[model samples]
Every structure is written in structure tokens, then in C-alpha cells.
Target: MRKKYLFIGLFIFAILFTFGCTSGNNPKDSFQKYVDAWEKQDYKTMYTFLSPSSKKSISEKDFIAKYTNIYNGIEVNKISVAPDYPKSFKKDSDGNTSIPFKVTMSTVAGNIKFNDTAYFSNNTKDSSNPWSLNWNIKMIYPDLNTDDKIRIDKTFGKRGEIKDANGSYLAQNSYIESVGIVPEKLGADAENSKKQIADILKIDKGVIDKALSASYVLPDMFIQIDNLSMDDTDRLSSLAKIPGVMLKKTPARVYPLKEKAALLTGYVQPISADELKKLSSQGYSKDDSIGKSGLEKIYEKQLKATDGAEIYITDKEGKKLKTIVKKTEQNGKDINLTIDSNIQSALYDQYKVDSGTAVAMNPKTGAVLALVSAPGYDPNDFVLGMSKDKWNSLQNDPNKPLLNRFQATFAPGSSFKPITAAIGLKTGKLDPNADKNISGLKWQKDSSWGNYYVTRDAAYNSPANLLNALVYSDNIYFAKTALDIGKDNFINETKKFGIGKTLPFEYGLDASKISPDNSIKDDIGLADSGYGQGQVLMNPVQLVSIYTSFVNNGNIIAPYLNAAKGTPGKILESNVFSQDISNTILNDLTQVVSNPAGTGYGAYMPNLPLAGKTGTAEIKKSQTDTTGTENGWFIATNTNNPKLLVLEMYENVKNKGGSHYVVPNVKSIFEQFCK
Candidate 1:
């Protein structure tokens, strides 16, 4: 009986010993679990693996603080942990095992690679003596002591220049001197400095006084006075002599073309707080500049540069001990636009009217040569930070200088006659060669078509065919043609031309509406729309696109601004009109400019054979203005080289003589390019 009891006791003791040895020998498994926790930022789970002595030295809260505060400051984006030496754990004579590890951390600053060791030992609290990690700050980052920290420094890349087709600078960075006053540094001369600055810049004295009266004015801080031009170096030298005045040169976005190409080039401004929050993950900082409109806003991602960064290991005193990672910033790629600088300048000069828009494109390839919106404001104003008063003045201007007229809609008037003529021919509703006994003065569907009457000039009183009607721009002729085509076919044919749809353009465009919801309402309404009236609105860009079909033998190609030599034009519609039909329409349009009695005869070039149309749209009086106005429009193409198409529209020509107001400008633009 004694021998049996002794045997059972020895057997149980042997089993307990076996379990303790197995748990203590598996240090690699314990180290792997701890590494997994660290990678996930689960400090609590990591802390559970710490040996009894390690936990006593550093609490879980302190362990988490090390990762969240110090590590996060470096902008760590990713962390990867792997065995540094061998997969097996190394045992020391002290009954402890060490698992070597290689940690690579990817951060905004750069990649930081380092070696660390996680020590494991049998826990004193466990009777089984299970292996546990002897954790410490050193296990995460090598040589990371309580008084040491990680520091990161960022360097922004330089913005690229915007150049025209000829490589002339449109938008570029320039150095300007910012003059300001340091009030506290002025001592007894604060009042004198303010007066001197105001006098030198010819600015109001109250402006300087208000700037100095700020509650948070600091002695060493700068209070901006003005941004001095580079040409104002002499003035800057004189201003710097003021007691408390300081002048610092800083880089600024500048439009070398100024107001000439302002509408197309656009401008940039400091990013708002909301923008920063949304773009934070893209590495956008508070001080970054962002594009606000036009081409600048459209290609922001391509124009934006890649930011570089540097990471430093530093002591508590803020002295950088060594740089862990360094990266060089890559400058942004320069953008080359398709606009011809000379043609653009000529177009702007010829648009002498106060408010209007014009667009010229290659009819064959659809490459836009020039685009202009009159009453343009200098983009430099926005870039240099426009004052509240100046901004309000521009916003309130009657001409709407900030509006991009090229994208804004206008009643096409008789300029839309060609489209109406096309619809009539396509639907077999009108005979191009046969003469119609249409009234020149007035016409209506019938007596029951209400009191609505389509009136025309008495000059069109003679028997008229398609050719003669187009030359005279007889409103009655086109209106009669639209009614004959019927409402459903008219709407469907117009839709085929992409009317009432938003044009696909890189620079945004407002959709042209035939009429809201394509509704013609009644026979009179349909007739009114025939001559580009009754809710029919078209933008200059789309108008040029529609005209290109006549030039390209009735194959409509959507106009594009940024086409290279071999880039094929996108075909919007095929077989819009047969070759014979397109030729007949082209011949009739040519007579409008070539014929002596044609309305567009004034737009004829001396040597260039021009083909085009003219229009005059009436505007109704509105609450904003008591006087109604007329919008003059003209579109033409060179008869020899049909690829060159020009479109011009003049606004608010109340008493102006019909389409005659736009003829000279259109002629001048063609002369510049064709001659």
C-alpha cells in the first residue's frame, strides 16, 4: 500500500515538471504574439505579455502613451515587423531567451528601419513558469529613451509654370516684397512709421492705423502693409528706411498676361479650413495654395507637386541627434496649353464691346485656337489676396467681369438658322432649290395660331429659295420651315445635334437648353424657336461645335481645346446631313458673306472667301434693368480652309444696329488668322 501511493505521487510530479518545461521553452511563440499586438497598436494586449518586473517598471498607460504621442508625431503611415536574425529564439545562460526583430516603419517623412530585441523569461507569478516578454520602450524603437523623441520636417515642392502654345508664360511664380510694420518694435516711432508707410504706398492712413490697433499685435510679428511689385524696388528701399517698417520678399503666384487671359488661366488662393480637413489624407497642409477656378481648378492634381519630408531622432532638448530618413521633393510638371498667345491677344483686342464672348477652333481637328470673355478682371488680384472692397466692387460690376461668357448661354438668334435649315432639309420638309412664296414682312401658321406673327425685313420681299433666304436671314422663312417640320421631329433633330445637353469639355460648360424639358408648347412657340427665340439658349463653345458639322461634310465632331497633332476628333453624330445636302447648305452660307446684299456682307474679308451667318436676339426688360437689350451674334468660317471657324457674340447692345455690331469684330479675328 505504501509503494502504490508513492508511485502515484512521483507520476503526478513528473507530469507537472513536463508542462513547466514546455511552456518555458516556447519563447518564440510568446515573442510573436507580442509583436502582433505591437503592430496592431494594441498596447493593452502587448502589456499582458510583459514579465512581472517589466509591468512594475512601466504601467499600461505609459506604454500606450509612448506609441500614441511620440510615434504618431512622426506621421507613421505603416509598420512591418519580422525576425531579424534566425526564426528560433536565442537562449542565454541567465535562463532568458531573446527574439531578434527588424522593424520597418513607413512614414510621411520616409522609411525608418531599425533593429530591436524582445526578451522573454519565465513569469514568477505562474507556477507553470510560462514564458513572457520582458517588454520595454527599447523593444519598439531602438535607443528610444524617456527623454528622446522623433522629429519630422517637411519641405514643399515648387509649383509649375503655365505656358501658352508658344511657350510664353501665362501663370508663373514671382518674388514680391511684402511690406509690414512691427508696432511693438517701433517703440516711440510707431505713429511716425504708420504715417510714412501710408504716404509712400499712397494708401489711406486709416488702413495703417487699423492694422496697428489689432489687440494681438506683437513686437516681432508682422502686420502686412502692401505687396510691392518687383519694379517697386526703389520704393521698397525708401519704405524700409521707416523706423518700424520691414520688407520681406516672398514667392507669389503671378499672371504675366494679367487680364488678357484671366478668364481661361484662372487663379489660386490659400486652402480653406474645410478643404484641409477633406484633403488631409492627401498630405495637404493649412498653408498650401489650391486652384479656385478655370483650368487651374480642372487640372489641380496634375499641377500639384509631390511634397518631400525628413525624419530626425532628437533629444529632449530638441537637438537632432541623427536623421533617420530623408527625401527630396520633386517639382511639379509644367503645363503647356494649346492657346496661341498671338491669336488670343488679337481676339481680346477685337472684342471691343463691354461684355461678350468669342471662341475659335479648327473645324477639322477640333483644336481650339483662341477663347475670350470680355470685361476680364486681373487674376493677379485674387492671387495676391484681394481686399474686401475690391472683391465687392468686382462682384457688383454691371458687366459681370468675373463671369466666363464663353460658357454662359445666350439666345443664338439667326445664328441658329443654319441648324433650322439643316433640320428642314434632313426631314424632307423643305426644297433647297425650289422657290417658296414666303412673305418677307410677316407670317403665321394660320389665324387660329393666335396673334403671334413672325416678322422679317422688307428686303426679303422677293421670291426666295434656301440660298436667298439664308443670305437675307429672313426670320419668316426659317420660322415657316420649323413649323413645317412639326414639333416632335424638330425636337428630335435638335437633340441629334446634342442640343439641350451638357457638352463634354475639360473646362466646365453649362448645358444648352432648346427649351426647358424640350417643350415647344404650341405652333407659334415652335415657330419662335425656329429663329433662335423662346427659351432657346446656346453657349459659344457649343455653337462653334454645331457649325463644324457643315465644315466637316455633315459629320459632327465635338470641339476640343487640348488636341495634339494626331489626336482624332470625337465624332458626336454621323451622317447628320448627306454630302450633297451639306454642300448645298455651305454654298448658301457662303453667299451670306460673298453676296453684296447679304446681311453678313460687312464681314467679308478682302482676299478670304468667308461663309457664315448673323443674328440679333431681343431681350425683355427685367427687374434688374428697366431697359431691354439686344444680343448681336456672328459665326463664320474660311471658304478655302473650312477648318478655321470663328464665333462672336456681343451683349447688351440695346440700340446697336442688329448683327452689324458683331460683323467687324468677326472680320478682324479672321484677318488675324487667315491673312
Candidate 2:
């Protein structure tokens, strides 16, 4: 009995051994081992193949160290040896026989399943001589049941809509369904799929061919182009009939007003390298979107939308079967602005013909009504991608089409007279009645000076009183006031007026408006500033705020910004100041604008009941010209309404028949708006 049992065990062992000897070696693993041995110059293995280098200088140690490290789906799985391929004798470019070998690549890099077949026939003519991969890797990314799998997902959050102040949709958010595919699932037809898709999308077929032919491993499917005429929401329904394509729902950024508020609203682009690095450092990927310019950039965190990722469950055939993991996308915070889209649109339409800015704000609340910088672009231009031609035109334009001048420089011109008037009254140096004594003041320095004219027969000129000073925008009249107030006091007063500072707003800003220097005590400098020239400058909004202070009774209120944090909304900060000199500046300014000979007579707005001043400063024409145009300006405030301030500036040079050119432009806008 013992002998019989032992014979049975031995027979079983022999059967097991015979089976192990025939198929025990993992074909894929054994093939790799043979390749590794051949690489190391093992004579036995090398005998079976041609030596790449006759010298065989690399030792096994060196060979092991030199092996390239690649992380891929194949590397992740324990692959089995494949069946031997049909004998092939392929000719090289030099007419050498091509060796044929077969390999059973795993379904994917990590998954152990396999489908399809790989036939390796040596290709001696391809330029790159790249290793070709064959066989099918079932995509398990989407669920096994095609209908149950998700093709694409929102990046992180639900998309937010863009709306105007009146709750009108200007730029809105919507979802687009797109079809995606796994290259391996198509087997030998991946190339055909690429060509077909490219042709349907009306793109360069070569691009598709290159992408498809170069793909050795299955790559993430990105739907580059889609049916433009078809409804985005119904994309899946139409595309399901397309070959090797799956459907996914995704949200895209959109622009509503298009070119209307393009410049102001700005545009969005794919995250840049630097921007991507910023996000990666914050634990985000390169797919995130960031603001490129304008309001979007200024308020990136608020306007930016959030995206969510989809966790796909794929079948063994490499087809997405289901989503076992998913987090609901969270949309980004919505931003409500102070800009009134309708008014801004109207102003932009008018400004399209000119290069200027239009700003409207409440004198009391400091809330900006419409802030416009001309030459607006279509914000949509930046949504998908910006063309180099469009970008170059804007960059190279002589008019500085992309620059925002509303809060930048408006060339104080005569509009600056209001501030000088305030400086005079604020410092207590102007005795509104001081000009009553029309005594000629001497130029303390006899040195050579700029184009300065102190009336040699000053006594002959009309009284240079504060009223007459603002009335005529007399350079000499205010020059006397500056000298009386002194430069130190002037600088201090100017800073208090909020110059050389940025207002808190949603749009990107230009921080160069007001500059005051005590060193500008020269009769020329002081005189220039007296009538709004030399070193003094202000923007339309700044001028409005300055005049508003006078109307607000000594309160120097900070400019209003549309971007701030509030309850269910953002609230901008408003700083107010009430100094003792309030009454002085207001009373004197009223007298100046009311004066019959006042240079600002044209500024009189009966319905608005405004007080104002006008100015014409001689500056250089352009950067290179020695003579610039006569810059015209008008600034006003209505104590009766007490909520609106208006400032007008015109760069009318003596060249284009002077004031006939630009002043009328400013007048027309003011008339339409104020009325």
C-alpha cells in the first residue's frame, strides 16, 4: 500500500513538473529577462541576437545602472509571456532581414487584464526608430457600461454666471457635453479615429496624425474640437453615434456683453507656467484658470470659478463603466461690482471713437457709476484663446488702446483749478479778499526761468483776487496764493487730497495722478499749479472727489470702489474728512464760477446748479514735440443736488484748430450725462 501511494505521489509530481516546465515561465517576464541579459552582454543571450556594439564595453553593472526608468501601466503589472509571432523577414532600409517577435502587453499600465495583439516587426527606416506598441488595453476609466460612465467632469466647482448690476446676464456660465476616447480601446483603428475626428473638426489632419502615430501608451482623451452648430447640452446625444467617443459634461467660461465691457471686464486664459507653479505650490494642478487682466485679475479669487474632478470606474476592456467616487463641484464666489453695465456700455460706445476715459460716481456715496477706458475688446477673445494678431494690434496701437486713463492721468488742465482753490482755502493763506489789494508781487529770483510771465505792469491788470483768480484761471493770481501758502503747506494739503494713491476698486489701476513737492516753490512751478499745471495732475474720478469734498462741506471723502467685502455682497470703504477750511474753499469756488468773467462760464449747468472752474494749460504736444496742445479742462459740483460731481478734460491743441476739436467732445458728453 505504501509503495502504491508513493507511486501515485511521484506520478502527480511528474505531471506537475511537466506542466511547469512547459508554461511556468512568465512569457512577458522571461522576455524582459532575455532583453536584460542581452543588454548586459551575456554571451548565451547575446548569441541569439545581434550585438548593438561589437566591443561590448558596458559591464552588467553598468548596464543595470543605465537601464531607463519609466513609470507606465505596463510596468505596474506582472505581465505574462505572449505566444510567438508568425515568422517574418522584414527588409531594413539597407535590405536586411527584419526579426519578428510577439509580446502580450497588459490591458493597461496598472491593470492585469489584456486584449488585442502586439506584433513587433523591426522597422529600420523610421527616423525616430521608436519602439512600437501593439495589443489592446481595455480602458477602465469610464464605467464598463458606456452609458453609465462619465466622460468629462467639471474641474472643481459649479460655474458661476456673470451679470450686470441690474441682474442682467452679461457673461454667463453653461455646460458643454463632449465625447472622449481611450486610444487603446480602438485597437489598430486609433489612427483612423484621429483622422476622422480631425477632419470633422476642420483642423489640420497632420496634427491628428502626429498625435495618434506617436502615442505608444494610452493618453488622456481631450476633446479639442466639437460641433459648433449643435446644442452644447445635447452634445452627448449626437456624439454617442460617433466611433470611439464617450460623452462628458463640462462647464466653460463665457462672455455676455462681448466687446462692450471687454477692456474693463478683461479676459481669462489657460493658466500660465508661472500661474501653474503658483497653483501647484498651493496643492493645485496646471488645469486651473487664473485672471489675465482687468477686473478678472484685480478680483481673481472672487471671479474665478471652482472645478471638480470625476473618479471613473472602468471595465476590463479599458472602457469607463461607472463613477464610484465623486465630489460635487463647488462654484467660485460671485462678485457684484459698482459698475452699472448699461451706463458703461453707453459710455463705451461713445468712447470707441475717441481715446479717453469716462467716470461717473455719486458725490455722496462715492460709488462709481461708470468707469470706462476706451478701445474695449471682446472679453470672449480671451475666453478660449487670444490670437497673436489681435494682441499685437492692441499692443502696438499709438493711442494706448489698452491703457485705463479714467483713474490715471487726465492732465489736470483747468480741471485742476478746483484743487488749487481748495489748497488756498485749506491752508488759510487765501484771504478771498487778498486779491482786493492788487499790489504787484516781485519774482524773488532774477535767475533765468521757464516760460513765466509776471506782469511787469502788474498794477495795470485787473484785481487778481481769489474770485478773479479762479474766474480767469489766472496763473499769476494763483501763483501769489501758492507763494503765500508756502510749498511745505501746499505739499501737505495736496497729499490730504488723495494724490499718488490707488483707490480700492475691482479693476487694475494706474497709480500716477497727484504729485506735490514743497521744492516747487518757484513762481513758475507754483504758478503752474495755481492754474492746474507744472507738477499737479488729477484723474476724472479724482477731480470729481475733490469737487465733491467742497460740496460735502469740508469732507475729503475717499474714492469709491466697486470691490469690497460685505454681507452677501462686497462693501467698499469710504473715508470722510471734515476740516475747518471746508466753508472757505466752497464759498470762494462758488464766487469764482459765479463771476461773470469766470473762465468756467461754459460749465454752468442750470438744472444741476453746479459750481465750477475751467483751465487751458500749455504742455508738450507729444513726448518728442516741443509744443503740445492747449489742454482744456472743466470741473464742477452741485451743492443743490450735492450728490454728483462732473469733470471735463479736452486735449484741444492749437494745431487742429484748437478748442474746436476736443473741448466740444467733452462738452457733449457732460451735457448728455448731466442733463
Leading candidate by lDDT: 1
Q: What CA root-mean-square deviation does each model show from the true structure?
A: 7.3, 15.8
Give per-residue CA lDDT, model 1, range 207-249, as digits (tens): 9888878898876888897887766777888987888888888
TM-score of every prediction relative to native? 0.78, 0.62
Among all windows of 10 consecutive residues in model 2, the one with the lowest summed lDDT is 68-77
lDDT of each: 0.81, 0.53
Q: Write the per-residue lDDT of candidate 2 for residues 1-675, one digit (tens) a residue.
A: 999999999999998887654322213333344545433435345223322332154443433332222112112122333344334324346433322333232211112332333223233343232222221112222123423322334345543445555776555665444445555555576666666656565566675555555546355565344423224334345446556665666566666666666766666667777766456433234566676776677767766654555445454465765554444545666666656776666666754455656666667777666776666666665664455767898789887767766747655665676666667766667777665454554332345654345431123366666666665555556666777777777766776666666654445455434344324645566665665666666666766656667666656455555434422212222223344456655665665555555555544455545566655556764324665566555555566665545554444444543322433444455566655
CA shift of 659, model 2, Å: 6.8
